[model samples]
Target chain A: GAGVSQSPSNKVTEKGKDVELRCDPISGHTALYWYRQSLGQGLEFLIYFQGNSAPDKSGLPSDRFSAERTGGSVSTLTIQRTQQEDSAVYLCASSLTSGGAHETQYFGPGTRLLVL
Target chain B: AQSVSQHNHHVILSEAASLELGCNYSYGGTVNLFWYVQYPGQHLQLLLKYFSGDPLVKGIKGFEAEFIKSKFSFNLRKPSVQWSDTAEYFCAVRAYNNNDMRFGAGTRLTVKP
Candidate 1:
């Protein structure tokens, strides 16, 4: 079976620029998530989409960071006016169901974004 | 807001040596714990998880984690590690009621042959 996939494995952009990172979840998956992995900062949850709706988006750091999942299959995270602090590897993951005591998530190759 | 902590930043050991990585979460509610591993240039993969029942849960590659509710800890351990076990390990947690998940700063393990 095909696993989760992400595009543009690496991206380099200037400060104040906007960038969009894409994620394709596995077929039949209903839940999608985006995370940011920064140096010495661990994995920070960005957003989660159950189907095409995002019920919990409190993890988004700021208004400049937004994500949307279309048709409950693909998700895109857009960071507007990116800052040097936004430099990190963006990771995406998906699971079978939305709510579970323990839902195993499959991850995709992260997109390394460097804000210079 | 919930948070997770990985006390160790990096570790190095010889093959056949025992390994232990400490993890702690700052949530008191019912939670699910997991151990994820990322090999060199590879995506993250699930190692093990603990939801309920037995406090001691075993994972792939001879790895195991014990959940101590009293201490709010889930520490991963392995006996007689192999050089292939060298990688970055991350501990994650998800509450029982919400879909939000949190992960700790990963610990990089290097097992020499």
Candidate 2:
């Protein structure tokens, strides 16, 4: 039903501050994703959006990381200047578009970010 | 760098016992395997997936997985285990011509009943 939905489950910025993480996809999900889960690092893959052409930042890990997917759904993942290694646990996922079909992402209950 | 290897970060059993969990990955071509579960704070569910003809795949509740392309592995088993099947197990890999997906650094099962 209503799955993927993330927000500030927890965030505590400090180092060079600049954070914004949100994602709400699943009303008709046309695909949207952003992942991060540090601490020995595992699930990492930062940007993606389908159904609107451009956006596959190729696992964005630099450029202060950036992400956006609006109009097709809500998604945001901006981590400008934030460091301390950008903390971790920022995950959002959705599926239902991406042509090749293998759908099944649906996740959200993450947003730990803590860079003190 | 398509990596995914969950060589057990933690696993303690007791319930009905019997359950294996080990996933290995490192692409060079086709791949699509998954086994995700997270029952503590919840949010990451999908107990099975192995995009190809049986290599021993069955999922949900009494999960199963075994896709061994020689040893790129994709292990996850269960013969009996329940303490609510303690949680946190993730093993993912995607690249069949893709937008990318990779995960695995999780394995926290703790089934003690």
Candidate 3:
């Protein structure tokens, strides 16, 4: 089975510009999550969708950061007016179901976004 | 809210040497623990996970983790390591009642052949 996949393996953009990162989760995965990985921050959860509905959005750093999933398959994370601090690899993951403590998540290769 | 801490930032060892990486989480409730590994240029993959019943969980590539509830720790260990085992290991925890999962800063393990 194919694992999660992300688009635009590398992206370079100017500061204050907007960037959209795309993620395609595995087939039949009902839960999708987005995370940001940087040198020091490790991995920071951005947002998650459970069957097209996000139960929690608090993980998003700021209002400029938003994510949406359609058809319970593809998810897009949009960073409006991106800053230098937002430069990092954006990762996407998915599991078979949601809200299970024992669920194992499969990760994508990630999109490396560079804000210059 | 939950937080995870990886005590070791980096570890270096020779091939066939024993390995241990510490991971601690700050949460009082029941939690599920996991170890994930990322090889150079590869995506993160599950090493193992501990939910209940057994305190020791074995994962791929001769990796295993012990969940100690009394100490709030889940340490990953392996008796013998290979050069191919060099990678970044991340410890993660998810509370029983929460949908969100917390991850540690990760430990970089370099195995010298």
> DockQ numbers for every candidate?
0.77, 0.24, 0.68
TM-score of chain B of each: 0.98, 0.33, 0.98
The DockQ ranking, best first, is 1, 3, 2
Candidate 3 regions off by >4 Å? none
Q: Please write out the lDDT profile of model 3 over residues A1-116, one tens digit for every residue.
A: 79999998999999999999999999999988898999765688888888856447878999999888887789899999999999999999999987554578999999999999
lDDT of 2 by residue, A40-97 (tens): 6578888889878898898898998888888989988899889897898998888886
The superposed Cα distance between candidate 1 and the true structure at residue B91, in angstroms, equals 0.7
Model 1: CA > 4 A from native: none
Candidate ranking (lDDT, best to worst): 1, 3, 2
**What TM-score, over all chains together, does every model reach?**
0.97, 0.35, 0.97
Error of 2 at A74 (Å): 35
Writing each residue's lDDT as its tens digit, candidate 1 over A12-66 gives 9999999999999999998898999998878899888887564468889999998
- What tier of docking accuracy does candidate 3 attain? medium
Kept native contacts, fraction for each prediction: 0.79, 0.64, 0.62
Q: What does candidate 3's lDDT look like per residue over B1-113, in tens digits? A: 88999999999999999999999999999998889999999999999998887899999988999999999999999999999999999999988857678999999999999
**Candidates 2 and 3, the one with greater TM-score:** 3
C-alpha lDDT (0 to 100) for residue A93 of candidate 2: 86
C-alpha lDDT of residue A26 in model 3? 95
Q: What tens digits encode model 2's per-residue C-alpha lDDT throughout B20-73?
A: 999999887888888989899789888888777878889889889989898899
